[model samples]
Target: MPNQTTFTIKLETELKDAFTKIAETEHCSVSQVMRDLMQQYIERHEYKHFLEDKVTSARASIANGQSIPHQDAKAIFKTRREKV
Candidate 1:
């Protein structure tokens, strides 16, 4: 098994109660549900960063006159597709 650590958080009683009820309805432990939620949040955060980096790179390429025109790129892809 992987090494594990405990995390602590504070929330309102009503919020905790509602969350616990939902977790029970789903037949999942509170800890497991929290873990799943944390993983999803992390995945979304990382993907946001990935897209930001891609946009920055694309902008830099355009500024440096290194990007091909749309029609030329489309023609190139069309020829490649026909070769397959």
Candidate 2:
């Protein structure tokens, strides 16, 4: 891979062994596996933060009683769509 930065990471002995075995089985280097895992980890971390924000917004709306009943909401949307 071009334009890639390298870094050293410490892993538990057992975890290192497992990663090495997986790399061998997948016909790739441990470094490649770690890179893929890190990418997935970062993506999940970002998505988690987004979900947290959404949860917080929902909680605030509930606390402020700024919500309509679910059935009323659906009916309103249906009427709006029909008008559109």
Best by TM-score: 1
Name the lDDT value of residue 26 in candidate 1: 93
Give me the candidate number with maximum lDDT: 1
Query: How would you encode candidate 1's per-residue C-alpha lDDT over 1-84 as one tens digit per residue?
Result: 299999999999999999999999999999999999999999999999999999999999999999999999999999999999
Each model's C-alpha lDDT? 0.98, 0.92
Query: Local error of candidate 2 at 13, Å?
Result: 3.6
- Candidate 2: Cα lDDT at 61: 100
List clashing residue pairs in candidate 1.
none
Worst 10 residues of 1 by lDDT: 1-10
- Badly placed stretches (over 4 Å) of model 2 are 70-84
Model 1 misplaced stretches (Cα beyond 4 Å) = 70-84
